[model samples]
Target: MTSFILFAALLIVAVIAILLPPLLRAPKPSTGADHREANLAIFRDQLAELERERENGSLALADFEQAQNELQRRLLDEVQPAASAPSETRPGRKTALALLVVLPLAAAGGYALLGNQQALDPLQRQARITPQQIEGMVAGLVEKLKENPDDSKGWLMLARSYKVLERFPQAAEAYGRAGALVDQNPELLADYAEVLSRSQGGDLQGKPTELVERALKIDPNEPQALLLAGAAASDRQQFALAADYWARLLAQIEPGSEEAKALAAAVERARAIAAQGAAAAPAGQTAVANGSAVSGEVTLSGEVAGQASPDDVLFVFARPDEGPRMPLAATRARVGDLPLRFRFDDSMALAGGKKLSDFKTVSIEARVAKAGKAQSSSGDLFGTLSGVKPGSQGLRLLIDQVQP
Candidate 1:
């Protein structure tokens, strides 16, 4: 409708231009001195000629009449004035001035009615930075934080950057400081756990695990919490737990996305680990496999952390300190402040093909940290295989001063 109005207005202006010129008639011309002089000059010349002819006795009545008529015709021709000079260049040039005023106003009014101001806005036209560019920016922020640690926001950005870099420990430390600065945010806590796990030498057995659990408690459905929980569970051989965590995380992950694909792979890994444990059961030995609990007899023959003497505390508690306390899974003859060979002699209670009895698996961390928390939070299994496994020989692990 507005377009039609504008078009009609322009058409009206055009019709005015086409129709107005003829209606606005020019003023009538008045006789001036030049016109009178021109007429009188022709009349005088004819009269003077007639008088001279009469004096010379050559004038006749018919000749006089014809001569007078010729004189009148000459006078009329002489007095025919030129058309009056135009008052202005192209009559009524003021119309053009009116046009000049009207065109801009029309344009402005049209814009007010029809134009999309958002499209014309400079900010709206500005180009957006790509995700890769943003990631790069985060990286630079991290570098700046490394140089100048005082900037809290920069540290947070750096922490996020480290997460992108997969440098978990550094990310955790940065995130921890960020958390301290901003008062225990759930996201920061989650990032802290994630990085701390890798920081403690790729094992979530230490500082990272606790943070993850605490973070989860704060926010149950936190994406980071789910991801980290899955990782921690798998590390501890809690395959079913790992599967559940990852499956929950998959729901949060964008469908058919790279993160979803990665989580899916983790889920499959958990399933495989669970299947291996399930398949380890013997056909007729289900009673023994299902019935026998691990009898942890782990004997630490080494110096316990913060203890006054080797005899201060019994070896049984500290030797298989990390995982589930199975009575048959204890260590023996572990020397003080020395490398101890922890044996897994669960043959008495653990029948063949029973849990962990058949598999030659990885060593459980029986070593104690300075804080007396088990180095491995869950009890570490003896090996990483499924077979009729004997106790690990020449087993050695170093115990450093664990951070508080």
Candidate 2:
């Protein structure tokens, strides 16, 4: 709107500049100078003719003198000044005023008819795809797919496009078709798992975990597969396994890159949690107890250590690999008791059927519970280690990041 007003004002100023000179100019006065000059020249010419006639004996001297006087009188009549007259500028002023109103209106009307006002709107000027354009593109792809249903690359492209457009169900379907045609290519499998996970509210376990495992089987070092597997492990409270997967992925990427750094940090955190689980074994049970005991040391990170209270509860425990997420072996201690050593075995099981020895693998988590709750909650500082075999020892867990 501001830009529109500025352009209109500029147009008005330009019109005024073009028309002002004629409107404001003074009327020229007539002083008879041109008439006087014309009369003098005529008089001189007649006098010369009369003299020539006299010399040629074509006229009498008195007649020539009379003609000369007549010419002189006419010249004198022309040269005499006339009375002054008033100059009326009212008509010109009225015309100027009318034009001042009409020109601007005309220019504005013309611009309204020919110009695109939206062009001046910076937000509108940026090109963006509309819903209709997206629909058209999708229709085109559908038609192409109908004609070439077995084209793996086409299906892959369509799947990616659907993912970008946030049509997760369609993307998953397309990815499935592509994967089938391509014999479950590792990259496609990974992408399929990702979109499927997104469709399921980001739960990467169950089917998504299976897909990730399949991708890993095809190419164990595949970055996406490793990343997905690590995320799944972390979500399942298996920080140790997550660390292993991310560490493998980290080795494949360029060092010092943001992804590599993030993976390295995650690896360190997972290792810290694993160490804490190892320390969770009982005081006198440093040696293996039923082959499922986990022993480790738990401590807070530097950032959290200073602000943490000595009375804060630290919960360290192990959970079954595939059964319920409830802790299988657990213990609690105060923050002041850390860098406190911990030990956990089947004797600490919350339920008899959920013991660590019952599972082939287990996960360990250590949380600093400011709220003093046994169950993890928001704002609790925690770390985890996953996929530990029974009787792991000498692990270290650092309670660094907070639960969101």
Candidate 3:
């Protein structure tokens, strides 16, 4: 900052120096004697021209005399007494002094009004803002928005602030208020969908899914939209659609980047699932129609069995060995049903167009959910056996570990 001020001072000094000389120098004065002499010379030329006109018979003798007298009278009228000319040097000096004072002040004042004074201050530029300060600012914005509800930009800013604070419900409400502002913007739509999904316990169904789809339609390569769309398709067991969405997303990322590598891996998994589905379509259909079953016994391990309650829901499911983690087939029971026989079949598929016979190898899992939710949560007891075939029977599955 000191260096910048010094440099600016030097520039102002240079500008003043360049202008001072021109302003200070007095203008050449027109003296009375010089003016009278010039008038006499003009009178002489006029008299000579009158004589020539008379000799050429263009003027009468009386007319020639009148013309010469008129010329003399005009010269006399133009001439002034040769007196000392008033000094202009004083005015010039005053103007120079005024410029020296006013120019620097004007320049400084203009810069103070328009320039970024804090630009060179490193401390000011690098100051860290605390989370509390940010929240205060957001609160201020919210109050301002209340006073001016038509401010769409303010609403959008508030929405983003709420999202950053993980206040998802409030964020969704603010995004809704953003209204038409979010409709045309793909990034805004994607962010709105994310917040809305978070508000719904991370379920990107219904309105969130619709928003994701709308965002994708506007910009096919919108990264967040594509991610949400792919996840939604995977949740629906539409592996081919998920693969297509993820592949498009992968194409948009820079090669060799970590994000690109991760997306590429996801795309590959989705494609593997889609390929497996294609290969098993006919057999899976037939198996579902024929009611083929994979019967097994689920027994809780003595080591972890003490954690289970009699009424805790037990979920037994089968998923393909490769690709998305969605269940192909599942059955529900209670913790009291431990050491119970379970009949898993294509008929118990979790989603349409997917069946127990849809993969070469399937993994069977049994989870005792204390919260009675299908998804595994903390404190759940679970176990798994991989490489089980669709018609495998008399298999013993153990519920061994506690979900962390």
Candidate 4:
């Protein structure tokens, strides 16, 4: 708008320069002294000619005199001052005013027709299609990936785009393909795990855990693994374990970082739970007995922890530090060294059985041979064998139910 106004002003000034001089000049004013001089010179020449003519007996004195007087009158008329005329106020001011108004008006018209209309129409139209355009763009990306399947980066991008579009199956396929291209990449594995976990409704894919382990091995302090581990441990009711993972993550980040603050706050919450437990020990014991066994079938179900890597089993012994360190007696069923199930009953109290009922509190510790281990989980335990009666439907934590 400002530019238009400026242009209009300049145009008006240019037009005024072209028109003003002619409009203001006196158009038909009479000639004065210079004209008179020229006229007198002509008259004198004529008189001289007449004198020569008389000397040569070509004209009579009376005729010569009449001609002379006529010429003299013409010369005098030429020499006389021009007729007096009132000079109306110069037209320059009016011309300037006209240009000032007209140019701005023209400029405004041009601005409305050219700038506003032409510039804004396209912008508004483009804005209207923005959402669809984004979706279409992602679709195009996936299509391109189909044509060039070998491009790892392209596959990764397409997978992420598919996830954004909520095409879970396609996203999983794309992520899988990308993983194949870039094997052992912790970040890629982590990203894959996130997608798989979401697509499977919180069920960690076989590959994600493997990736998590690999990532931890690659970078012991990887925040994502720590966070995932913390959440997983928390889900298993390992409050202290969760705190450990979260605290480790927070320590790695800058103290003032937002992530650091958030993780720190989470750790604090875990600590509060621990404190609450400590405070309500007697009251909690009356209700939550540690020595009892569950009566009903717990339907133990979970993937075998060491099926893929038996040497890296992370068995958690959930028991209080002050109590008999040997856990309450329990029977573990192993299918060829793969933890298949755990049986808790009266017969589980022997020296050979895993003592499951003695501890007032429980947590887990796993030996991970990988370079890095996952941090404590923030997720709550599905159930704990911590407080079971001697003959109650105690917890039968299915290995298959373990969700990380």
Candidate 5:
């Protein structure tokens, strides 16, 4: 700010220096002075003519004297008024002084009224809004929405705001109120699906999956929709479909970016799972595919069993002991079916080309979800048995730990 002010002061000084001198200097004499000088020169010429006329005997001495006297009288009359006239340059000097005072003040006043004074303040430029302020703004928006319930655009904006705040339920409600506005917009549909899934404890089944499908139909290349669709497919154990969706998403992303690298890794995993499943398809005809089926009993321990509701989902799955975490075989039930007998084989493989027979050893897990979701979350009961052979039988898997 100091530097800016110094530069502005210097510029003002330079402008004043350029303009003031011309205004302050004394002005040239007026046309009356020129007229007086012209008249004297004329008088001198006439006097010389009169002298020549008398010397040549063309005029008498008396005539020559009279003519010279007349010329001298005229010259005196012209010179007297001009000599008595007051100087006109004083007023110009006064105007220059007035301008010297007014110009800088006018410039400063105009800038104060119109310029951005806070631009030079780094703190003001970098200031961030507090969370309380954001909440207040959202509250105001909510009040406005209540008064104008038919405002679809407002509802969409409110939905996005709620999503940013991680208030999933409110975001879902706002998206629903957005009516037809969100229905045709692929991005909004994807966002709505995401928030709806989040609101339901991250289960993308049923409506959330349907919303994602709708977004994909509208714009097959929509990135978020493809991502969500891939996740939904992966959750359903359709690894081939998941791979396809992610590959499509990958095509739209810039290569060599972090996001692209992560996505590429996911696509490869899904494709590998799909390839394994495909390889196992022919072996599905056998009862155990060379004794690859693993038989087990899943039981919830008494300590965490009481914490699970009857309708909560139960997932039993096996992953390779040393490779990617994608499940090779899986089965689902409910908490009410605890202490149930379970079997996983090539037939139960979730992906087209992956099977339990492929792994020499695997890790089996059982999770009782409180929210009926496949993915474990806080308060879910789960247990893991590692280094178990695929063809192992009569294994007892206990749900002993509570996810935090």
Candidate 6:
């Protein structure tokens, strides 16, 4: 406010400085100095002509004198006394003063009508809106949305704001509105799916999962959709599918982001679970192919063994040594079962016609998670051995590396 007042004062002063001279200047005097000066010039010229006439004998000395006296009399008659000369009429000072007043007022009125005064205020737009004020604003928007249901972008923004505030139900409603307006928009679909999941206690199996799938169909690499899809698959115990979805998401995300790091662990854990499921074949199925069976025992390192609880999950798996490093076979056991024996063969394959025997060389890995979840999180212990040939016998795996 103080700054504004100062600016206004300075502006008025500058306007006055520019206009005052023309408005308040003293009227100049209208003297007869021009008339008196003209008469004196005529008299001098007449005297010069008279002297020339006498020298040329065009007139006698007496005639030149007489002409000079006549010229003097004429000059006296033309010249007026300064005290009796009339002063020219000066323009009214009142008009100039009126112009001075009108110009500033017009300028000020024009600015008031057309200038954006709010732009000069640094906090006028958003900075002054506090959290509580924001909530009120959101409420106002909600009311507006109720009145006008066709504002798609408004609904989207409202949904996002509600999501930030953890008002999942309201967010879901707004997201629905936005999604309805722009079907097949990947970001909207994914956000709507996520909000719907949250509103329903984080259950992604039904409509939420369907929404994510739809979003992915529109944009195969949409990161949020891929993540939700992976989570949904994991919830359904389709660990391989979950891993594949997360891997695609990981490739598109910033590699150094916290999300990517967490996701990398998730992919690893999924592969481990998938491997385990494959290796532990359904009842009545033939044991994994014997031709390429890899048998190994996982033991916890003494240095980190104390961190595990009996209920903690342990994952052991084998992946391709060369290309498309998805797990071929895997199995899970409790940490209490560490130093336990495990085997991988065709029965443990992720899908039919794919098995440990498909690759001559393979990599083996083991991870221990305290949460008992398949996806690895922070503090999980893991270790790996690369370039191992299939059917290797009596191999010993150690769980040593710690996920940071």
Stretches of candidate 6 off by over 4 Å are 1-128, 283-404
22-55, model 5: which lDDT tens digit per residue?
Answer: 9887767667677777778887888888888899
The CA lDDT of each predicted structure is: 0.55, 0.76, 0.80, 0.55, 0.81, 0.77
lDDT of 3 by residue, 251-288 (tens): 55665799978987887797688667756779756556
- Pairing residues by index, what is the TM-score of model 5? 0.46
Candidate order by lDDT, decreasing, is 5, 3, 6, 2, 4, 1
Task: For candidate 2, give the lDDT of residue 366.
Answer: 86
TM-score of the candidate numbered 4? 0.47
Of candidates 2 and 1, the better by TM-score? 2
Candidate 4 vs 5: which has more lDDT: 5
lDDT winner among the candidates?
A: 5
**Local error of candidate 5 at 287, Å?**
16
Which regions of candidate 5 fall more than 4 Å away from where they truly are? 1-14, 17-118, 121-123, 282-404
TM-score of each: 0.37, 0.42, 0.42, 0.47, 0.46, 0.42
lDDT of 5 at 264: 83
Off-target runs (Cα >4 Å) in candidate 3 are: 1-124, 282-404
Better of 1 and 5 by lDDT: 5
Query: Candidate 6, overall lDDT?
Result: 0.77
Task: Say which candidate scores most in TM-score.
Answer: 4
Clashes of 3: 0
